[model samples]
Target: MDHTPLRIAIIGGGVSGLSLAYYLQKFGSEAARQIEITLFERKSSLGGNAETVWVDLGNRRLPGKPGTPYRRWADLGVNDVNLATSPHLRTLLAEIGELERLKPLENTASYFSRDGSVALTDDRELFRGASDPSHELSLADGGRLAVLIALLHRSAIDLVESRRITPRYTVDDFFDACAAAPAEMLSAAANALNVDIDWEDPALPERLERLRHTVYYPRISAMYFTDDRGPGGMPLQAPFEYYRLQEGGSPPDRRYFEHGVQHWLEALAAHITGPLKQGPRVEILRGIEVEARLSTQGVTLTERAPGERRWEADLLIMATHAEDALPLLTFGDGLSETQRELQHILGKVRYTRSFGVCHTSATRLPPNPNLWRTRNIEIRGREDTFHPYRIDYVVNRHQNDAETPCYDRAGLPQFFVSLVDDLNRIPRSEMLDRHASPPDAPASLAGAALGAAGYRDRLPAIESALEAKAWTLFKHNVLDAECLEAQAEIERYNQRTARRRYEGHRGVCPLLFAGGWTRGAGLQEQCLKQSAHLVALLLAAPERRLNPLRLAASGGQARQRHSQASGFAPLPASL
Candidate 1:
């Protein structure tokens, strides 16, 4: 028997890349023992957007422990996970032995205007567009509740009936077909869904597919209604009660990491590369940016570090963001037609700069503490100047423990993470450690000075952390209209090429793309599912064909059952 191992190289240390490595090991069985994996990350840290910062509360102690340092951790990115909808993530947590660490939290939000008068707590109030305010405008004070609800019902009907319409159908098209959805409502929906565009503009409308994939459109539409079949294959009318459900469903079962998202990533990584891990030899290389070249021979990865190291692998997975992955691939007229097409499709994905600050700022929340929910969406200044994604997460509400240390006895020290589309909105005092800077601001790599330790090394000292909070800046990549179209094309291309490969035709490049960007919506679930599907394809037997639906359903539950039934028993003969 040939014991030669399959050499695999994965770029990007985010959920996509990590999950791919993990599944490969979990499913490869004894074949996994013959697989060698090299994971590369540009940042010194492993987790990409799953970053956490520890804050120090000077002189404050956790209830009884006075000797231990008083510190609490808060996620700077990827804070919440809807366990009900996230089977893949749930499986991962279980496999990595961290499933029990899931801390349930109430996922509620209060949307109000900057002047503190318009509090839209429920759908009726939201549709009304305002509560009681002197000059505040809620959701642009658009249509009455009855009118908006009618528009939604009509829009849902149109989407279901017109299922054959081009994927180019945009939110604008849906609104046009409905003819009664208020423009202000579109603006609000655009903001909530992170469209970041002038949604009302006839020239540029957010794609309906992108919005649907985002799955956060309950505020805007009953897209889920399009899924539930009624009698003769028509979409069932969604329950009117859906309006009460928060974006992505705010069930009592919603969970966040006990330590933070970074801890979860670390635990998964350890399970993948630790000594106890079975199968493949997994090596993680950090603080190294790699460029890839593909040929009939194999993949050659060249690092940007001082020595300019190089490595070889049979297959390369570009799990990095679309922006980061585009440049690494071989491009231009020199490439195959398929390669060129793939490059073009990948380049279509768009990204925008986003900023966030983790600070002890009560000012970022609603004026009335009573109005605070898990998430607070405040309209700063005025309606005309409203930012689409100015959300503040109350970290305290996410804590598993009922009581945590508070530095001051007068009032509990509240930790809030404010995500603003505009960096200028973050107060200067709150933007401590210079960890983040405005996009237009001259580039600062001060945080990068932490070397291989990454953000973990950049953590502020207890005293310093108490004085100046932690801030983070990351690329807010999105699968916009063009990106969604590109994804469809890419899927078609992959399917055709995979069929050809099954017939021993190596027509496409020896490369694969895995990331939330490759699919729809930059959510963790998208990343995990896409990566798992890619794994099934990469390791499938010659006669086997990829079934995304089957893989999605099986990967989580099958592996989970296998692990639980018998401790790390061999998987079934086939995935």
Candidate 2:
């Protein structure tokens, strides 16, 4: 084996690993030279949870002889890619020429409750589309909500008075403020937190008040669907705030390959392993157990892939979720006491499970341009229920043509609904052994009195309901079970414990963990930024022995270009 060339092995070919590979190939000098890179994925395909399915319109022949085939992407996990985390994602999209295919789901409607009521949550719709006078508000409700919002904003401002703002406030404290303050006041506080509120006038207090009323408060409790129980639940604060802040725009001006995200990822993999000379899907070891070790070469990974074969890597870049990574790492393995202590702290990170139901049919819903729905009912033991949180539905507009309103496509409504659930209360053991478990582990009956903080007591019921409903809906449409499971695994990996383990090997390992799980920020943009930062660090490493002449020449050119552009004269040739 050639020791002169650096051998890099990236475990888990998910978004994080793939993005890192992309950046490394584009930026690393020796990436094509001395650097030997190999990406290992347990699954046959890449893209991890970013999987898409194609629904055959021809199969469900409608009134029209042959309908066009359209591809449906399962955002089984992530839907909204926040722009704040990584601007490079936009650049990546542009480079791939698929930026135009990126369409922002219409931000018009949100589910207020499980009963399927729609609310105009978007600012444009709230201001112009509100039909009911009460929903629109008559100066009085707006005024009251406004006054409350102002006070809440003032309190938040006071909390950070003269000090750096930090995410130090507990979720309880934040919810208490919302619950105690007037609806309008809560709205104002929401606006301060980046919730968009549309006001016609720039300065009028009344207009401002109307905007405040539109600020949907976060449900402090857990949320569940009365119609169908599920394995997953979500925090009221995250989804509510997310929906309230979600913005939309026309589709990007690029073309999607039409196959799905998997297709694109396959193309990326080909570019890396084929043209880039990196090994592609070298080997997939399914039930391989991993444990941490240390040697003179630095941190070592003891991996038992499928069979009796055991392998070791000088540096292992784990792109798996935190939960999956947890079983691979141990605190006793050459870890410092401080590292062990930090692991304890990181283990506290938690996760919530969520489910999605995608429906495609020959008929469509009414042509309500701004159709939206938000969760309304607040389930006991689960507080966070309502708009921008828990579950959301999206109706694709591009499928409909000029004569047909987006919602009125041959009377067939194709909608995707997401249902969020809590998993903290439910034990993993119970889930794996639901049949053999005790009576307490069984599903709860409908309308059963679920005591406060009794999520464990209610797990079986929720899980049962989720399975039944999911299967029923999925049977009618195409199902993406593997993608859904991958998404769940990703969520489990985001827990605090997983974070501690990864952070523990921070400086010691050449393998850097950069992903949504590592940072607990699951947005695509964040992943891109982390990838770029990691690539830059790897490229600048002095130990790599990159040519100094190349560096100086590049620097000289940069200076020359800067001087010429700034209209400065060349440096004098003085001795």
Candidate 3:
């Protein structure tokens, strides 16, 4: 066989694949001249899950045209873009000259039950205000809660450094410690903190047990924080603090996307597809089936276009979401045993169910507002529909216009509420029966119920309720579920084996594994760091790559310092 330039096919066109393409073009060596790269997308446009759509409001018109309607671009999913998850994304944006576009979302404010109505719950104020006596806490109980907080704070600090915390901690630890403390102190602490812990309630033990088994242990195992308190009421405590300490400060303003993230992504795609002229010249074959085979020559991919033409490539990189790409690969000569095994491991990578309702031409809410929380509503047979958690409205914080909120100015506010149920654990049949089908009609229920009850009624209640002029319901899976430990181990094994398999070909495959699932743990910062690691792997592969830990330990200077510090000096050249 002729030793020719390598042909590379990037299977998914999401951010990961695009990022890889951008860097491969920017950094590949002169030897990379032989590399031919093609990026394939099942969808006509790139961005994959990151796509956004503009909803037109017939009643609302822009200033110049009375009859012309206005539209607001609704980010169908991924409302928050964490700077900490992946520096590669940040670097990619910077290379494209769009890093300035990164922005931060407002600090979250929650609402909880108060006097049979909802009241504001600010985490900062809640922690700060705990010292005040009027808040009420018995000395003993207060001491215990204080001790718990201190331990948690310490644990959080440790997690920041090592990214590993023991999964053995349970709800019993929380309750037992409180129970063992002085009764008066516990009572006072409860009163002072205004925490609603009903010790005498018959369901207390069972609730605590449920929390231990389902929430606390699982979250600890997954290495992500849970709310445990606040409106969403997750089992783990101090979520925002965990992120702040680990990732180092809040992300760029999320609402700063002037034209929307899709705009930036499109701009990025245009630059890569048009100018950089990188590796494996991309031949986009829309509406074609991709087939992968282990040919005698090497791995060959045959793309069959609509009219029955075949296109082949030496190597294929699957960058689409695992769920979507898994099916595509399975259709061909079955995935290698190793790949099939990896898929099974990936199966344990759970996702949370999320439902978004978009309302257009509706009365906008105040900037950085908190929607009210209702009593833990149970969906009969569904354990606790509200059990794991839910989020009200992630309002646009970058909305600067006092009169017109959000950039598009469709005269409506963009609010996203998540249903937050464990997608993996739920039976498929039950999920289909419960949520697969859309409601008979799109009701303005969420906006009306959460808004009016939360006391945003500067306008008449009836008017506020009627403000929801038009709406749409979207159901998708949030990549925020816990991966069981057994599955994580399998993934680790598969990754090692896959890396070894590619090494025999002389050229290491540029295919990289990423996403929330592959991040070891699901913290946003972990995802960001993984992105950096992927970039490093791509840069140093088949030659100078450093071990994962050493790279992480030395930060970006691992290669430079490792050689010098190890005392394995290179011999001088003879004259």
Q: Note the Cα lDDT for every prediction shown.
A: 0.55, 0.37, 0.39
lDDT, model 3, position 543 = 32
TM-score-wise, the better of 1 and 3 is: 1
If candidate 1 were superposed on the true structure by all CA atoms, what would the RMSD be? 11.8
Worst 10 residues of 1 by lDDT: 566-575
TM-score of each: 0.70, 0.57, 0.60
Show where candidate 1 strays beyond 4 Å.
Answer: 1-3, 30-33, 61-69, 122-166, 175-252, 331-334, 379-388, 400-411, 431-469, 497-502, 541-575
How far is each candidate from the true structure, as Cα RMSD in Å? 11.8, 14.5, 13.4
Which tens-of-lDDT digit does each residue in 236-280 have in candidate 2?
A: 222222211122112111112223344455555555555435332
lDDT of 3 by residue, 1-575 (tens): 33676666767565556655654555444332366667766545455444343444345656787764443444433444545433445556677777775554343333222232322222221221122232211122333333333223333333323434333333334445433442332444334334455566555444433333422233332222222222122222233233332223222122335444455656666667775565435444433456555432445565655554444666555654455445555323333554666566656554433333333211122222233111111111213333343333433332222323444345444433223332222222222111111132112111111111111122244333333322212222222223435325644663563465445544333234554445433333344444444444444444344343233434423321222222111110000
Sorted on lDDT, best first, the list reads 1, 3, 2
Model 1, 462-556: lDDT tens digits are 34533344666555444335666777776776566545543555534567778766764556776787876776666654314434435556654
Off by over 4 Å in 2: 1-3, 30-33, 55-73, 82-86, 114-120, 123-166, 171-264, 276-294, 298-312, 330-342, 359-389, 397-411, 422-511, 541-575
Candidate achieving the largest lDDT: 1
| Residue 49 CA displacement from its true place in model 2, Å | 4.4
**Clash totals, every prediction:** 1, 49, 26
Q: What is the lDDT of residue 416 in candidate 3?
A: 36
Instruction: Answer with 2 or 3, whichever has the higher lDDT.
Output: 3
Q: After superposition, how far is residue 405 of candidate 2 from its true place, in Å?
A: 8.7
Which candidate achieves the best TM-score against the true structure? 1
